[model samples]
Target chain A: MPVVELEGVTKAYDGGVVGLQRASVSIGRGEFVFLVGPTGCGKSTCIRLLLKELEPSEGEVRIAGKPLSKIPRKRVPMLRRNVGTVFQDYKLLPNRTVYDNVAYSLEVIGEGRDQIRRKVPDILRLVGLSTKLHAYPDQLSGGEQQRVSIARAFVNHPPLLLADEPTGNLDPETSIGIMQLIYRINRTGTTVVVATHDKEMVDKMRRRVVELREGRIVRDQESGLYRPDESTTEFAIRLRGELGIGAEGHPN
Target chain B: MFFFKEALRGLRRSTAPALAAMLTVLITALVLGVFIPIVQATMGAASDVRDRVVVDIYVAEGASPAERESAQRAIERTANVRSVEFISKDEALARAREKNPRAFREGSELLGSNPLPASFRIVPDDPTKVGQVVDRLAPKGPEGAREPQLTAIDEVRYREEDTQQILSVTGLVTVVTGGLALLLVVASVALIANTIRLSIFARRREVEVMRLVGATNWFIRWPFMIEGVIVGFTGVALAVVLLTAAKESVLEPLSDRWAFLAAPDTIAYPLLVGLLVLAGVAVSAAGSGLTLRRFLKV
Candidate 1:
């Protein structure tokens, strides 16, 4: 069974502003999927919907076979506990050390001190942030901060991890490191869904790419490039012409 | 334990606002502590004065000895009368001389006979029922009549106007103190809540991060509640210390200077302190709880 499924989900805000319409996507356990779209193309909206932060106006959202609408208000935290999230800005608590930031995830769940002591360092090592455990968020570089964010998100070992523009602020070299980290995390049987706008990274990874345009899913394919095929749309044709390159499938 | 640790850390981070809230609690408790005793003491003094009031019935000078004796007997037999002491003419003269010795010595040569009249001092079973006893003993006369309808009784006095004034003043004192106390309580709660809100506002981003990380609503709120309790307990303890100091330095001297208006001893000191501490903690916790209700939407 798919670990995450959205069947014809539609989200409409006040004044009939469409956030996402008829957006259906599914991912099985341990699969890495990329959610790529332009700004305001419902990328963040999908993440918000999956987190149950915003309810869909129509259709069903099922995470791990449990319908989101059926989950009580009091149980939203339980749902979130199972789904780890990473953000673009690396929302680390400024007052806390890297170790504390990662341990906070387990602390909120009332994990024992021994469990936290054992888990926090292990996750910090996984994120390659073991040396920076005692450093504060401001004391770290942008890439280091993102690593701390990853450590925090993965500390609980949630089965499903959603990253929203995780490397949006980093340079290309640093972005590669973050992508590799996420890729390594997904290899451990955790289904990873990443919403990003980095076309080069998406093309290089060549994972299942789901493209959204104007709040609608325009493309979903295995080993898909960031842009559509040249013949499909004027935007893609002009983009290919500008780059002076023939239509060619990205290498696996 | 995590919540408590977080609360202690939060307190250290937001020391200024936390201290402000504690100061507000201290001031609130201090006002209550000082005013409560004053109110009790004032009421006690009023009641003491009320209890001292008695009805004095003077016997007419020209009345026969049998008539005077019969008047005394009549006063003693009144339903509300607790006791009656008959003062003879000689005893009345002696009392008058003792009250104004120089005047009596000079007046005794000028006047041949004693001017003071024999009287009955009537103590009522209930101080509030003194008027009833007086009515039963004094004979009713026509309106504006200067003389008593009964020939043996010359006059009846119970200081009705003074008693009325005392009662009205006591009522006014009670009402004014009650209103002031209520206003102070509301102001204290608001001040403390606002202080807590300022600290919460400072840490709102942290709260949002906690919520997004799947912390329960109570998990987020427990730290704030613990902070409030600490502030409350500390403020009340300080206020109690100040109150004790004031009692020794201020109230004790005042009670000595004004011996007639004695301080109330009805409430034990320990009990008063315990109640103040309880009130302080309750108000502080309630203030924080109320403020958190609006901010802890997660």
Candidate 2:
């Protein structure tokens, strides 16, 4: 089954602003997808819709073929339990130790103490933070904190992972490491959807790329580049034409 | 088990807001504790003054003994008349002599027969109702002329102006104090809720992470609610202790030094303490639970 699908979905915000417009997209189970767009182009809105954070003003969003709109508000947590997410801000529990942070996911889901004891360390090890198990989020570097957040998100081994700019705050070197980690998780048959504006990263991955512009899904390409090869050319030609340049490219 | 542990851990994690919340509760509880008894005691004194507002009804000199007895019985039956004491002419003379011994002794040689009028002293059930009692005994005529409502032999006397003044002043005190008490209770509730909101704002990140991980709203709310109760309980408990100490150390000594300062009856110390503790816990827990709704919408 397709793990995530947005069919003719439109999200209009307050004040008559449209965040997304009639966007239809689908990702099969275990497929990796990238949502790339300029800021304010509804990239975050698309991610938010899939997470059931925003109800579509039109159309439907389905995860694992179940319409998100049908899930009762009280059951949103259960829906979230099956999906993992990482954010640009690395929303770690600041007061908790690295071990507790990762283990908290399991605890919330009511895993047995013995299972928590067994699973928490293994996940921390996977995030390469075994030595810093007792360190608080504030004590970690930016990259280290992101790893802790990742470990926490993936510790439940949720079937679907949605990351909205997971590496936005990291250095390029650190960003590469985080994305590679995410890539590895995606390899394990967990469908991953990453929403980011990182050009180098998106271009390097060459994954299924969906781009938004002015709330419209202007581009969707398999093995796509961050920019559609000719998107900026029309803009350049239009600007030149306004400034009295000839069709042959000289100013007349 | 998980709920409590999480709550305790939350408290340990965010000591500043928790302590702030506790201190807010403590200060408010302490102020209320001090203010409540004072209001009650003042009210008691006012009531005492009200009880002292009395009406005196006199009988004629030629009235028969049976007539005097019937007059006394009628005064007792009058609405708002709590009790009536029959003061015979002789007894009135005796009381006058005791009150002004020098005058009585000086005038003894000139005195021929007892000149004091036999009267019944009427104590009203409520001081504010003193006018009603007087009017009941002396109903007015169609032209607003004064006439005896009952078969009173001679005269009726009371400090009408003084009673009116006392009632007005006491009524004002009640309104002001009751208003102040209501305001403080609302302030106490608001103070705790604001403190909880600030603390929650501080932990928004933690709450965000919890939501990301799929923790239910109740799961997150339980810890905060418990923490709020803990903070409130301790704060008010401490306030109660301070109140008891203050009452024992300061109020008791003052009351002893001046008997009039002591109320005949006020809210029992035990009951006041129990109510304060209940209020603190409720406000604290409610503050946390209700304020949390905004954050959980994410």
Candidate 3:
């Protein structure tokens, strides 16, 4: 069964603003998918939908083959525990050490002391932060802090992982490291979905890319380019370049 | 158990707003501690004053027993009369002697016959209604010729001016003091609640992230609520300590000067303390729950 599926889902907000318009996509287990678009193109909306943080206006959202509409509000937390998530801000408790930050996820789910002790250390080591266990969030670099966030997200070995602009605040080199860490996690049989603006990384990875434009899915391609087949505006620009038209001023 | 440990850990790593919430609760509890006694004393004093709004109707000393009996009945029939007691001339003399034995000792012995007039003491059910009893029983005919109207009665007096003055003054005192006390109590309690809200608001981002990581609402709520309870308890404890230290040094000396403060109806200090503790714990728990709800909407 597909691990994530959206069948004709729509999400609309107040003032007639539609966040996602009849967008449908499905992801099989262990698939790595990137949602790429410009700002306000509904990338975050898609991520929020999968997390059940939003209610689709028009259709069905199925996670792990169970319809989201059927899940009671009381059961949402359990659903979240099984879906690890990362964000751009590296939402770590400011006062907690890196080790405790990762351990918290386990503790939240009522993991036993032995299990928490075993898993926190193992995950911190996996994220290459075992040496920085005692370091507070403020004491770490942005890259290291994002690593701690990722470690916290992945400690439970959740079946599905979602990252929204995971490297939006990081330098290009650090962004690559974060993406690599995410790629490695996907390899462990966890279905991964990323909503991002890093066009260069998306093009370099050549993964399945689902591109959004004004709340609608404009393209869904396997091994897709970030700027898939020239859009009308891009096509116009290319034609202009070839014809030796004015580049800086409109040809009158 | 795990949540409690988490709560303690949070308190140890306390922020400025958390400390502020604690201070607000302490100040609120302190206000209540001192104000509760004053309120109790004022209410007691007001009631004590109200009980004195009695009207006395005096009958002529030369009147026959039948005339005095009819005079007593007229006082009883007056409007707003709760009860009327007849005071025979001899009994009136005896009460006067009892009240001031030294002053009456020689005076009463010298009088051949009891010079005191028989009287009817009137008590109204409502103190403010004392004027109604006075107006109905007092002689009301043309000034000099008023006696034919209430022939057996010589005078009907309620200290009407004094009764009216007491009613208005006490009413004003209660309305003003009660209104001020009410305002202070609401402001103080709301301050405590808002301080708790601000403390939770300071950690809203932390709450947001926890929700992102799939923490249940209860999981997010439990630690903060526990933290609030601790803050509230400590704040109330400090206030109680301050109040206790001042109870004898402050309240006792003041009560000696203010008779109403030592009245039997005053609220027991221990009971007031218990109520303060309960208020602190209750306000803290409720404030935390209500404020955290806004953040838990996601």
Candidate 4:
């Protein structure tokens, strides 16, 4: 079974506004997937649904083949132990050091001090932030902060990592560097789902891309590039590739 | 434990507020510790003076010893008198000599006779009943002599000066110290509550992150609550120190200044500490709980 599966999912917010409309997708373990859509196309909402921050108004969501509702409330934290989320805004707590921010996930799960001291350094090293462990979030550059956020997400060694526009605020070089770190982490058997409008980054990575338009899945394919329907789509198609058209009837 | 470290780090960020809170708790506990015992001691001395009051009932002239004994029995049987001791005319003069040696030595030369009257000293159980017993002893009939034959009681005297001083000081100190303690309590509550609130506000993002991480309401709330308790306990410790200092320097001297005021005894020390700590923890918990209600709920 897929690591994350959403079937006939619909989300209608308060005041009768619909966030998503009957969306369906299955993300397998160890797969790197890109969720591409225009702004307000329910990308963040979809991420929130997977994070169990919000329950869908209709249909069911299953994580690792267990329905989200079937998991008891007491076990929700444990369920989150298997999934890590990163925000484009780099939700690093401003009051905490980089090491503290990374160690927070483990601390929430009641890991001992020795375990945190041992594991936080390893995770920070993994994210190329070993030297910046003592730095506060405000002191770091945007890319460094994003790296800290990534470190916090991956510290628990969760099998699934959700990135919601992970590079939304970085320069191209820094964004690429972050993408490389994410790719490296993904290679270590963590299922990575990145939500972004960065067509160039998505195409350069060349992962399975799921394209959404107006809250519905427009396309899902492996090694796929961004489509040209929504914002920056034309740029995505140009940055990546397109479906080859044959000149002859049978073979090109 | 990490949360506590986080809390301590947060507290270190602003030393002044922490100190201000600690000082508030200290001053409050000191005032409480001192004010309570003073009021209690004052009340104790007042009641003691009131209980020691006795009414002296003089016997009629030429009354037989047996009649005087019966009169003493009657005085004892009265509802207000706790006990009655009869003093013969000679005995009265002798007691007077003991009280005033010069009065005994020159009494015959000045008066030309032994004119002192025999009296029954009446000790009333209730201090308030002394006046009633004196009134009852006065002559009831217009035709009768001003002094009755079997008078219920006579002159009523009490240690009024000492009791009055005790009562007045107790009342004044009670008002002043009660007001001060109330003010300090309010200040402590506000200081502790604001400190915890600021800490929670600083960590609001982390709290939200924990919520997103699927931490239960209790798990998210526990750390802040624990941090509040730590703050309260620390404040209480500082308060106990201040109270100890006040007990030695202020309360002891005050007790000496008024010997009737009981010493700051060691027995009340544990009770003072217990009350201060309990109040600190209760206030901290209540304050943190009220402030975190909004954040803890899903």
The best candidate in terms of DockQ: 2
Which residue runs does candidate 2 get wrong by more than 4 Å?
A: A227-252, B59-78, B81-98, B101-119, B142-145
Q: Compute the lDDT of residue B115 as modeled in candidate 2.
A: 76
Candidate 3 per-residue lDDT, tens place, B33-97, comes to: 98877887787788778888898778776789887777677766667888988888889989999
lDDT of each: 0.82, 0.86, 0.85, 0.74
Tens-digit lDDT track of model 4 for A1-252: 799999999999999877788999999989999999899888888898887777899999899999887776567777776788888888877667898887778877888889999999998887778888888899999999998888888887888999999999988767777888888889999999999998777766678998887788888989886763445756555434433221111210
Clashes of each: 0, 0, 0, 0
Task: Candidate 1: list runs displaced more than 4 Å.
Answer: A230-252, B39-163, B250-254, B259-262, B265-269
- Top-lDDT structure, candidate number: 2
- In model 4, the runs with Cα more than 4 Å from the true position are A15-17, A110-119, A211-223, A228-252, B1-10, B13-24, B27-187, B210-226, B259-270, B285-293
Model 3 clash pairs are none
True-contact fraction per candidate equals 0.54, 0.82, 0.56, 0.28
Write model 3 residue lDDT over A1-252, tens digit each, in one string: 999999998999988999999999999999999999999999998888888889999999999999998988878888889999999888899768999889888888988999998988898888888889998999999989999999998999999999999989988667777888899899999999999988766866789999999999999999886887648776665555534532222211
Per-residue lDDT tens digits for candidate 2, residues A1-252, read 788989999998999999999999989998889999989999899988977888999999999999999999999999998999899998888888999988889988999999999999998788778899999999999988988888888998999999999989988667777888898899999999999998767866779999999899999899887887836775565455434522222110
TM-score-better candidate, 1 vs 3: 3
- Assess every candidate by TM-score: 0.77, 0.86, 0.83, 0.69
Residue pairs with clashing backbones, model 1:
none
In order, the first chain's TM-score in every candidate is 0.90, 0.90, 0.90, 0.89
Q: Candidate 4: how large is its RMSD? A: 7.6
lDDT for each residue of candidate 4 in B1-298, tens digit (9 for 90 to 100) = 6557766765665456556555655565566666656655655554565555666667777777777677777667777777777787889888788999997789857898778888877777776656567656653457644444474333334454654564466556656656765686677678767766665665577778776655666776766666567667787888788778766887677876767555433236788689888888777766667777776543
- Indicate the docking level reached by candidate 2: medium
